[model samples]
Target chain A: MDLLTNILGAIATIILAFVVGMSYGGIVRKITARVHNRLGPPWYQNFIDAYKLFGKTTAIHHGWMQIMGPAFLMVSSVVTLMFVPVLNNGGWFTNLNFKGDLIFLLYLMVFGPLGMALGAGQTGNPNSAIGVTRGLSQMVGFEIPWVMALVALMIQFNTTTITGLMDVQQMSGTWLMFSSPFAFIAAVLAMLGMFRYSPFDIVGAPTELASGPVSENGGKFLFTMMSSGSIFSFVKLTLYVDLFMGGADNLIILLIKTFSIYMIPVLYGIVSPRYRTEQAIRFFWGWPLFFGILAILYAAIF
Target chain B: MINDKNSQKIVDIIQNWARKHSIWVLAYGTGCGAIEIPPTMTSRYDAERLGVRGAATPRQADVLLVTGYLTTKTLKRVIRVYEQMQDPKFVIGFGSCTINGGMYYDSYNTIKLLDKYLPVDVYINGCMPRPEAVLAGFGKLQEIIAEGRANGAQKYKDNLEWYKANQKKIIPSLLTTDYNW
Candidate 1:
């Protein structure tokens, strides 16, 4: 009975994440269209697109690895979702918030991209190869400040698990956003790259790279990637909410918090232009790196 | 129930509905008519509102928008691109150039009839169709899709030899590697 309930809880969490994430993606598209002064598709457009792609008949693939690419991405996304806590103190929503889960999460997040890189390489498309390199290089660029920020939080709170950090925020009655402003700033800056919005979006560079890594993917392969992408985005946002904004107690607060957090990258991406790989690395290492160090200093001193 | 004709019809209806609402056009600008595409995609026109957006590659695209006059030289590449696209795909012959060849009707290199080489699902008739015309053409395609009438890909499959002969007449050195799939 316990095992069945756990399985059901996991399924519920996956469904919730997929729905919220897909809606957020649609909202971003609408927001982007509105910014450009055009009427956009309805907020459920992503769902329609995903369904269409799912129903599409895949005719060709380079090899087995090409077929496995989306599967790897889906695995990464679902696993990451399983690890994230959706709501604070909510039974069943906390799927696997074990000790030292944050460190495990940092590694798990990159696993999908690397697996995708291998699959893309098998397709033998030059653009996919270039995209994979740029993506990994950009990953290296951003992970530094992101790691520093997390380390600062860990040192200050003296806890390795997300739930422990949440407990600290709850007991203190103040979110970490206020208590550790520099870490938040550094992390948010790293997130701009993590989300791979404009400036940092050189990995895909759709106009130039033929959509980068997924250039050869279509039909069911594309559908899996698309849905996994939505789920992954939700996982990232919920992790942020848990880490910095104080995890929400209910679904409404969770939505509001995650949406507000999502707007940071989406709005920034709209106005900014693309950055070359080196320039993006430089940008992250510059101000965000300095802020990360300051966050460590603040944590150590106080 | 899964194998029943009625159930299959219901599935087709739902699939058509979803397909009609999401059309990813290939961003291959084959000719001068490409200029109008920017405005159509941008704020003033915004084809995205109707679920029409540019896809970056042949693999990802549903609709191949042949923008303008295709010389014998370019037709080879266009045929290759169209073939690379997956099943249930479409082709839109844009501008007067792709139809009767417009001013290029007398030109030795330009192919007059596009449907001779690939099945064109819709044609936007103009020297250069404005953004409004482009959107109208898309609406027509969407209507055809919703009605289960857009079967250009299937038509191409059924009459491959005829289309290949037409293509080979223009580009005698056309490679057959694209047809193997």
Candidate 2:
């Protein structure tokens, strides 16, 4: 029974990952279109693309580098999956909950982009080189505020396991969104920056950089990236939802909270112009990061 | 022996031929021309009724719509993307850029004619073409697909170097001091 349960869970996880990714992608596309006052592609548009890419031929830059790209993508998303809890209980991998700490899960988040950069760097393509450089730039810009926000949250909750944070809301009947609003807002902004949606899309701007690091990856590798990116986004969003709006016995409220948060950035993405790397750096380093750190100190005192 | 096998093959062919009309488009919204492609595709103009919807990747898209001017830099990447798509693909040359360079006619970076570099079916003309014109082009391409002459993917594979030479007419480097992707 345990073995059968594991098989079913793994299969279910993969399917959810696929749908979650497509849903995340759909929302991004639809919201950007709405922001522009235009009708975007339908919600399942991302799923269609994934299906389409899988059917197409794969282009391996150096052939060998293909292994690293998908492996890292799969690994990083899998790590996120392990840390994330479902239904107020430890998710499928309870062992991860036992052995891994908050630091481990956070470290896993850093692995993905680095792996992508290394894989692209080996391709020796100039456009991809520029893309990897911008990804690094984006990482450098957002990391400070993201860290500050996490630090603040840690001080407020006084625990590291993501479950503890979620459980805090469940036990206290107050979501962090209302609890440490500043840290919550900062965390939201930092995550959006990490996603590099609009303006901050300096690294992979179609008009400027042209798909950036993923430019060279085609066929199976592109498929893997799409699937992993889609799934991981869902994982990330779920983590956010779990962090902010727990204890909703009614699923509608939870769905509404998740969808609304996703919509906020998506709407902004539509009407916005891609930011020059300099603008992004300024946005991250200036007031946002400063205020985020201030929130941590405030949380510590209170 | 030939009659029995041929008739069975013909039956299989008819079923497959009926499937191509629902051609998904992978619209590479490259430039200004992409403006018109989607409007022609949505409920207002209703491309779904015509069996064409914009797809995110080149793989699922049977029709690759090059909506506007292909910058020399973009064309190289375009070729790479085009090559990645599966067989039985159709390249819809939409707008003046894909047809004859549109507003970028003299721009050193733009490809004056996409056909010189890539095989194009159904040239739909307009500097910034209307949604109706895009649908008309889609209709024309679908007709070609139905007739089985629109599959350009196989031609590309058969003579890769011959086609790469077709793009040699483009001196993309002349447009920039140092060519950058």
Q: Score the docking of each candidate (DockQ).
A: 0.90, 0.15
Q: Across the candidates, what are chain A's individual TM-scores?
A: 0.98, 0.91
Candidate 2 TM-score to native = 0.76
- Runs in model 2 deviating more than 4 A are A90-95, A247-254, B1-88, B93-118, B125-131, B139-149, B158-181
Q: Which stretches of candidate 1 lie over 4 Å from their true place?
A: B178-181
The residue pairs in collision within model 2 are: A21-A230, A52-B60, A58-A219, A199-A274, A199-A275
| Candidate 1, position B180, lDDT | 57
Q: Which candidate is the best by TM-score?
A: 1
> Which candidate achieves the best lDDT against the true structure?
1
**What are the per-residue Cα lDDT tens digits for candidate 2 across B11-93?**
53553343344566778778888788657865567675554665545543567888788887788778866765655577888
After superposition of all CA atoms, the RMSD between model 2 and the true structure is 6.6
